[model samples]
Target: MTQPYVVRYVGGPLDGRVDSLPATPEVPRQVVTYVHLHAGPKIVHIYELSYAVEYGCEYVLRVEDE
Candidate 1:
């Protein structure tokens, strides 16, 4: 079985959220998609796996022009 590790989101709407996920091959980035309202267009937030700490890792939100 794979060990589960904690991932902390550093910015954007999901800031401060912590998730326990299985340890897998590290990816360069993570993507989050959400809609503001029932009729609103979907928004994509990109995050990069920035660094690691004693317990797990941190994903920092990436800012870019759409």
Candidate 2:
């Protein structure tokens, strides 16, 4: 199984909050993806991720930008 990626609002009113995605083995692992924002509360301060999945190993690295 491929490890999943979770997006969390790092800063703003939603800081320290996490949104999760379901995992399905039928999902193709070799595809690029896009994220669409819903029409709701707005966000401030973009968060950057320093993580990627290559090979069979998994990693989670967090480095905040100020």
Candidate 3:
């Protein structure tokens, strides 16, 4: 079965961090496609990521804009 991307909030002023999925290598990889902000909280800092998936072990890099 296709694995779903996982989202985990590490910690931050803006809700939290986002972690991609596969959960583990054993599962089939999946593209994040996009992060639809269902509900954006009021915060000072926030980040966004977007792109296409062409291979395995894809990553969604995140860094502070400031």
Clashing pairs in 2: none
Model 1: per-residue Cα lDDT over 1-66, one tens digit each:
778777788788778888876675566345544334446676777777766665467777888879
Q: Which sections of candidate 3 miss by over 4 Å?
A: 13-42, 47-66
Q: Could you tell me the TM-score of candidate 1? A: 0.61
Output the number of the lDDT-best candidate. 1
* Native-referenced Cα lDDT, model 1: 0.69
RMSD of each: 3.5, 8.2, 9.0
Q: Per-residue CA lDDT of candidate 3, range 1-66, in tens?
A: 867664443223324444565555554433322344446853333333333344333334345569
RMSD (CA, Å), candidate 1 to true, equals 3.5
Worst 10 residues of 1 by lDDT: 28-37
**Sort order, lDDT high to low:** 1, 3, 2
Clashes of 3: 0
Q: Quantify all predictions' global Cα lDDT against the true fold.
A: 0.69, 0.41, 0.42
Give candidate 2 misplaced runs (Cα > 4 Å): 23-66
Highest TM-score among the candidates is held by which one? Answer: 1
Off by over 4 Å in 1: 1-3, 22-37, 52-55
